[model samples]
Target chain A: MSSISLEVKDLAINLSGNQVIKDMNFKIKKNTLTTFLGPSGSGKTTVLRAIAGLNQKIAGKILLDDTEIQNLAANQRNIGMIFQSYALFPNLSVFENVAYGLRVRKEPKATIKEKVDAILKTVNLQDKEQSYPENLSGGQKQRVAIARAMVLEPKILLLDEPLSALDAKIRIELRNQIREYQQRLGITMLFVTHDQAEAMAISDEIIVMDNGKVQQQGSPLEIYTHPQNIFIAKFIGNHNILDAAQLRSLGVELAENDKSNFIIRPELFQISITGDSSDYMAVSGKVKNISILGDRFEYRFITENGLELKVEFLNQQQAFMIETAITFYVKKDNIERVGI
Target chain B: MEKHIDRIIAKIVITLISIYLAAPIVATIMYSFAKSWVNTILPDGWTFEWYLQLITNSDFLSALARSIILGFVTTIIAMCCFLPVVFYANVYDESIKAKLRFITVLPFTIPGIVLVTGLVRVYANLPVPQMLVLLLAISLLSLPVTYQALDNAFIAHDFRAMFEQALILGDSPIKAFVKVVIPNIRVGMFIAMLLTFTNAFGEYVLTNIILGGNYETLKIYMYRLMQSNGQASSVLTTVYFFFLAIISIIMIAIMKWQGSKKAEEVEDTKKL
Candidate 1:
């Protein structure tokens, strides 16, 4: 068996007359969760739908287990999808909705019941077996949708913003539950979402996309700490992008042959009241604004040259009044150089 | 104070509208039961003899049966033709819906007289059965109601997602539609079928113009009675009005049941 459960090569899709997904290529490993993270019109869902054989691909190949299956109808593809809307059949009870696939395949009555009951238990929804979808809460309905898709035992499961419709607390709980179930069942999952934090929370690998293209794909830590371009730097976290002139004004000199933008994370700057550090590049600034972010303090520092930069520090119950003069330092090795 | 006045005004308006709408039916009912009502504020006597006579008439029973058969056949044909088309338009190709908007205005643009004239010109001499042509024409005429009701059914759910999910679960398109899509929209479909059946049941112009007296439907029987006997005609009209009232009651009851079921679901969700 191939290590890759699903692969898309040079996939392109057009809706009406405009191209929605362009030359998209990605591979999902077996029993691992990968996320397609991007903004709304970034073609993330388009690529995911193409992989499930739901959307027609104008040009490309979709391989499942190293065998081409792009031409197969969506039903024949043996893939499952959970939509953001939960898409539960309002007429069917929870058990019926979960058993829909098994019933379609003509599974025996006893087996369908056994499988549905087991899967419903896995999602902690055994008590909701007789409840219709409309009577359930959003979180409960989503759980039913998950159970319905998972009961089919698909080769790969595609989740399109499954938690986007959920509340904050429920979203966190459901995402953790989904990741747990994916691991327990050993099913390959392709999750699509515009929320970066959700993708970072549960994905084994995150493919960041924008404007119908894959901007970057990597482990969450790698993508977060070492963004390859300015877009990724700006999108992934609160990173300050400074040009050569801005860096010079901040008392940090670029390399002799280098004039690219530097991506500096907020927490990378070490702040102090006294200018005692000469080994690292340093600048003096005042705390223009301070936002108490529960666990950390985000300080907007303005340097002598009037260059504004964001600096963050772990909250230690210390007091720093507004307009307090402070010095911040960063080593040359800590900055990431990104192209224009 | 303002709210009380508003309530009073609303009640008066509703009462006036009710009287205006119900006056004709009330007069017809009174006429059906009157023994000698001419030039009198009230009937000199009331009797059930007209109703008994109409009920005993063999032609009246056959006319009622024919109208029912027409209703059932037209409803079946309308569902067969428009259900799949409306589902396709709503789920897959929304552009088809834009093309189908013309069906809604077809009756206004081409009156039944004009359509029957065209149908007679084309199929009057053809080997095709006139009854079949009439049935087909009636079904076509009822398409607007069928299409609109069926289309409304799809608005409440993400039917595409539900259908695609079912397909991914191993159902062919037809099987998925029958198993998953149909149940979700059954209420709406039922309401549509009822409306179509009601429309076809009460049809007069196309039936009279196309099939004529050969297919003596209830409406045709009523029209004939109107010229010959006033008491008998009033009785037939009253019977027709009751039939319509029963159908209207059924439709309203179904709508109310559906609404309550939805309200219960909402209440359940809120409790959750």
Candidate 2:
């Protein structure tokens, strides 16, 4: 069998006179966890649905393992989908729910039992065989949903914000568990989430989407450290954006009328003595506010040009005093040039 | 203190209304068992003689059987017919679904008498049997009600859940309906069945006009018997009341079970 890879080319979807997804394109390698990250209404879920053949009337081709699946119905596409709600069959026992796909294909009862048992074990839900879905915990329900979809041995597994409905602690725990299971099975996985942190934490490749288009797509660290646009910069993590003109006035290097936005991460700003710049891009500012956050103190400051900046300092021993004049240094390499 | 007094007065008024609503059924039962039902504020004697009389009457028995059988059959047919239409409408598109919903409930908007008159006109031309015509009339009368119940049930369900379950499992729409949709909305289904059955059983005007004194359903039998003063009529009324009460109790029990099951499911999910 050919390796299961997914490619979407110039996909466009219009629903009720509104173009929700426009010319969106991406590719997922076989046996890798790829995530589509975007704010709500940014068409992340729509893209996933389109690939799964849940959304018709799309103007593009979706290829799975090099076969065009755009015309296939949702069931015929052989793509597994775990809904944001977990979508476990509320009426069925855990085993039956997991074995649902196999049962539908009219597999032998013994084979269904064996496959369900193995999949349940994979999801660490072996003990929940006779338990109904409503009796499963949020994380357990998510696991059952994953098991249910994966048992079909689908070409690709699509998870639409699976951890969003979960509590915080469970979200973290289940995220790791899902990643582990996806890796172990070598299944091509496409995860959708509005949460950038969750996306960065689990995905092998992350596609940042905004306004029905791909903002950026790269490895987690690459996208986080080198955002291609202001939207991706602000969306992936907290970043203080400054105009290129403002950075040039502060004696930072600039090409003639580059006119691009400069993004500096909050964590990259370090407080140092004005005279001890040490080959770093330094700017003088007055600390306007300081707040304690466990092991670090986050300081908000105003520069001479009336621009606001935030810096996170690792609190060593003393509390940071408010209204203190501090010189903060941002490494030149850390300042990423974003969209014009 | 003045506001509290107003609240108390409102409570008293509501309680009085509830009691007033229950008074008719209590009076009906009392009159059905009363040995001397006339010229008295209350029964002078209570006995099961009327009930016994109703059981032995062949016409009354046949009417009762016909009513029950027609009620159940209509309910089943309504469920089978309405579920697919509702499910398909809900799954496909919203605007079209809304139009379909309006059409399904069209029978309810038209007054029952007006609708039944139209049905009579249509039935008059057909060469169908009296029993089938009666069944069809009763079924049409209860159609809107059953449709509404099942439609509401379908609306309340997680469509994504149902669709995803079916899609992932590779199950056909029919299997999904049987296994997932039906079990999830068992309460709504039960209520629809009971309401449809009760409505069919008690319907008089359509049965009367359609049967035209030829076929006597339970309601027609009761109406004819009530016209002629006899203890046998009172007994039949008592039997009918008892049967209605039993059905009502069963429906209530089913609803309660459904509610409890849902609560238990919620609690179990929380525990997990």
* The candidate that achieves the highest DockQ relative to the unseen native structure: 1
lDDT score at residue B196, model 2, on the 0-100 scale: 89
Task: Give one digit per residue, the lDDT tens place, for model 1 in B186-264.
Answer: 9889989999988998999999988788999999999999999998999999988888889889889988998898798
Candidate 1, position B63, lDDT: 93
The chain A TM-scores for the candidates, taken one by one, are 0.95, 0.94
Global lDDT scores for all candidate models:
0.87, 0.82
Model 2: per-residue Cα lDDT at residue A305: 71
The fraction of reference interface contacts (C-alpha pairs within 8 A across chains A and B) present in each candidate is 0.91, 0.70
Q: Candidate 1, which CAPRI tier?
A: medium
**Top candidate by lDDT:** 1
For model 1, the superposed segments whose C-alpha errors exceed 4 Å read: A255-257, A272-279, B1-21, B35-46, B93-103, B118-133
Question: Which numbered prediction scores highest in TM-score against the true structure?
Answer: 1
Return the TM-score for candidate 2, rounded to 2 decimals.
0.88
Residue-level lDDT of model 2, residues B50-73, one tens digit each, is 777777878888998877877888
Model 2 — interface RMS deviation? 1.9
